[model samples]
Target: MNDSEAVMKLILHGGNARSLAMEAIAHAKRGEIAAARTALSEAAEELHHAHQLQTSLIQAEASGEKTEITMLLIHAQDHLMNAMTVKDLAVEFVDLYERMRASKGVEA
Candidate 1:
């Protein structure tokens, strides 16, 4: 597949993962740790898949063949970067929510 296609797929996977992670954090805030953890795991799997795709492309490009740069590629790159950043932050949010419940002496 072309670089743009590969990047787009990665962006979609990353976006899906990020969305799931945010929802997981929301669930955690409501004291559903089990559900939150499941969501987090699903998100992580998606991230891993996306990362793997990106890694392959990077390695391929390093072998002397450059992927053509296009607007679509730029867009996907932006989406991927943002998605990854948000997903990482969501883990902290989930943890924070769980701690908030604990600090309030509440049980999930």
Candidate 2:
């Protein structure tokens, strides 16, 4: 696949992961720990997929193939990186919530 297509796929995967991670946080806030964990797991999976695609693209470029950069491709890369960042932070957030729940003697 071309650079644009590869980047777009990363965008979608990353966006989905970000959205799901945020939703997981929201669910945890509402005292839905199980649902939150499930959402978080899904988020992680999506992020892994995005990361794989991005790694592939980087490897292709490293192998001496020329990559054209479009504004949309840049935007996609931005989205994917931002999503990965959010996902990392979300892991801490989820863990904090779990601790809080446990402190309150609530089963997760």
Deviation of model 2 at 26, angstroms: 0.7
lDDT, each prediction: 0.85, 0.87
Stretches of candidate 2 exceeding 4 Å from the true structure: none
Scored by Cα lDDT, where does model 2 land?
Answer: 0.87
lDDT of 1 at 69: 82
lDDT of 1: 0.85
Clashes of each: 0, 0
For candidate 1, give the lDDT of residue 82.
83
Give me the displacement of residue 22 in model 2, in angstroms: 0.3
